[model samples]
Target: MKDHHQHELDSRYRRAALPPLGALRCFEAAARLGSFTQAARELHLTHGAVSRAVRSIEDALAVELFERRSQRVFLTAAGERLRDAAGAAFDVLAAAVRELREPPGAPALVLSCEPTLLMRWLIPRLPGFHARHPGIALRLVAGGGPVEFDGVDLAIRRDDFDWGRRVHAQRLFEERVGPVCSAGYRQQHLQGQGRGARWDDGAALLHSATRPGAWADWSRAARRRLPAGQNQSFEHFYFSLQAAVAGVGVAIGPWQLVRDDIDAGVLVAPMGFLADGSAYHLLSPRPIQAGSVGAQLLAWLCEQA
Candidate 1:
């Protein structure tokens, strides 16, 4: 009788220590998707429902989980911790279900990368990787900023933000940036100008919303003045680069992303690239084994870089 009573008390304590499962599910969805609206859509719930559920979790925990900025939301440090735990828990549950349903195949190496770099540079080079290593399966996710590596095997990021010291980071390559424009735009606007000439006031300047201070950073590095021309802003860095390719205006381009375009004569970088004091790094939760697939991928990436 005493053992039974003690077991009941233990069960009650465990239940009390855990948050409501529904609220936790909502919080996990919001954190993974990075948007309340998207989470609501995925879960077939109203936006208000998702918001209230997340709020309930926050209220119970007495901590803010997300930083609301205008129309976007970002996870806080505490939120990231919860996200990692929730993601790992969900992944384990999912894998168990899959194992019951079917035989397991080769485990995929999940790699998260910055969207612009993935679109502009990595995707173009992925064919070679696949061809070289036919046995290794890859699952790529596009993201930036702080990463939750619970379910993710690897992350490729520039050393622009502090991603904490808990994870092992392997430096991949130096990041070099420069102003690039379509060759046609250069012929029309800068035909007779020297490489170090100040940007022409008549030409437009293409700017990326993601990197608002890119031009300013380049100006400081090159010791040159920016143009007093009309500025056009794009929602993403890739959009700005595409606009530059279309002869819309000059855009700050990363060397690795624009190297092929420059070589193909699609774009011209009159002022050569300069190191922007940032380097790309591969992040992992644990040290990679020497002969593992992760190590092979890392070695291949370094060779490519």
Candidate 2:
């Protein structure tokens, strides 16, 4: 009798009035990105397929969800309402999927961090964390900007942008930035330059595509004007820093990221580091319980900083 009752409940759920999951997914993506073309790219579906999926949803609901004007898409009133509902639903589903994929009996904390920090700083210190807390498994994903703590337990980011007020944040350390170069390059090109000397126009200026304004920001904070020089851009901040270490050029280096290099004589900060009015922060969705693995990791990080 219990089995029969359970089977009936499942059948009822199957017969519920709901749009096709695929259509809902397509509609949600289109609404969120405000571009069917971009949504198609994200979903790896053809643009026409995405359009048709959205059209099917509109037909079923009998409402236009988007307004098309000047080759741009804008969400209509109905779209905004549906977007909020669909986005929330997707977030819940995604979190569930992540939980389901984890190995049984092995609890893990997922930490999202900025790419350069992960590469240059956190990774080198992870051995210490593992040695201290062997029972807790740590998973790291590289990211920046506003963190979506769906599957992430913690995120480390510099306070360069607003990450909204929903999450609890703790200050890690103040950011200090300065121009750094390989020791060889400093000796050859900047041997006679004294502290806070004007930047030379002969040396190449290394730029990161990720942080194009880093040099400018440092210049502004140091109250000095940067003279024009040969510019070389790298795809990532870490790459630019590495280029600086390889004697390619001088790059704006965050003190934390280049501290070991400077201490080891691999790099030199002729101008020294200056506060850029930003600080690194550890962010989480909720206050971490004291003595928990997350809290342990947080405390360790604070000690390291």
Candidate 3:
């Protein structure tokens, strides 16, 4: 990398035994404005200083590069060529200096999200975010727990716990949930069942150990009797949702988490959606300032919700 950068600098800055940078600046300004006095004013140098710099450049190149008239100066044929080359060189140098002086990009966002939400919802939307804000990097950590705000910039989570005063919460969307199953499972087991059919009579119940009562709450809201059979349990909600998507069983999933799957026909909501009072929120230790990458990401999340 160092070799490549050096090569770039060499190609840009070295094409001839050029005059000093200050002399080149004086030459270009004097040639462009067609007057040594105006170039001196522009460069904050005296007219004699500009004349000496131009004479020095001409001596270095061994060419009479400018035509001097009474109180006026203009580029000769050789001087015009030098002026063009010098202007192009200065443009590249100015760009390099600008890049060096520009403030470093916003620090990469350290975000924490629930594993299930990260996998099912947030991951799918990341490509869009990256496309929009390519300068902003993201580091995602997964878990739904008491978040430590020291290293993390944002956390996407369901609002079910007491987050302390240091953490600020912004509601993204209310958590609406329903039972979802693979398309194949629904076709094989539920297609022939009429509207009054007992869908849960023999179907397997996929449970998340993290949210043990999700199935019960969904069943109560859907007004369906809980299946009596022993069901499979996963260590996390993501695993349960994966099992459901793989046609293992019916899993109670939040609408936001499973909406894409349903729309893509990977998972079908055999039962309809239910709006529970719970909500999803974007949480941070402190409020994000306007025009920051974190603020843009938060706004995008709210739009997605």
Candidate 4:
């Protein structure tokens, strides 16, 4: 049971191959540019190729599409009708592709990332991303766990879990972690052995409630037992790192999160860095194909990492 509109669309699709896309493109360029020679130059084709393509379209439609004059061309009645229709059709096609390649909300590319990664890593690097991709409007949302594919187009997370086929995953880099504290805090609180201080030297332990065992895991890697010291816990890693940055306590810091601070001398990695075998991964909805804005972003992230 086909409706009239459905039948018409079906017939259009069935007969779409008549003139062929190549011939239509050539015709459009020739019509718009006013010369087959100019159209060939714009298309990087031989002038004869453009002429043949135009002739092919006219032959297929059984109608002349141009009026040849002394070293000039004009659109015939049929040619004028086709030029308008083809121009409109190509415009619609181009718009559809632009909409599909970009994130659903026109210019904005919605991103979901772990709060710590967003605050400490991604946000800092966003200026370069903007410079490289001025057309991609980035909208960042902070949270962690399985990517909510509802409205978000991409996510950055540090996890080893499977995201399934609906999501495309690319490993950016492995996570290295260690204890970090403000340089001023170390100078004020730790007396002498600030050069290679032990965690047992009475610095407060800033714990992330989300990852309570971070200290213990780091301890195992460094092969040192952390003393049971004054404990302060924060609900999230971002807060815990902030507490450390504020000189309140030592926080188990992922290398990427604390790298800039450490390099800038704001934070000191007392125990250096250790790899815990985890990685930061870029996740995007699988519906986004290669060469799209999301895919381009993933490539940029990998390069930056």
- lDDT, residue 56, model 1: 92
Candidate that would win on TM-score: 1
lDDT of 1 at 166: 88
**For model 4, the run of ten residues with the poorest summed lDDT:** 191-200
Which residues of candidate 4, in runs, are more than 4 Å off?
A: 1-107, 160-162, 188-197
Tell me, by lDDT, which candidate is best: 1
What C-alpha lDDT values do all the predictions have? 0.85, 0.83, 0.79, 0.80
Look at candidate 3 and tell me the lDDT of residue 196: 62
Q: In candidate 2, what are the lDDT values of residues 169-231, reduced to their tens digit?
A: 988999999999987787666634565476567788999988999988888788877767789
Decoy 3 TM-score against native: 0.62
Task: Give the per-residue lDDT of model 3 (tens digit) for 117-208.
Answer: 77667767876877787676676777687888778888988878988888888888998898889887777656335446455456788998
Better of 1 and 3 by lDDT: 1
| Winner by TM-score between candidate 2 and candidate 1 | 1
lDDT, candidate 4, 207-228, per-residue tens: 9888889989988878876766
TM-score result, candidate 2: 0.64
The order of the candidates by TM-score, greatest first, is 1, 2, 3, 4
- The lDDT of model 1 is 0.85
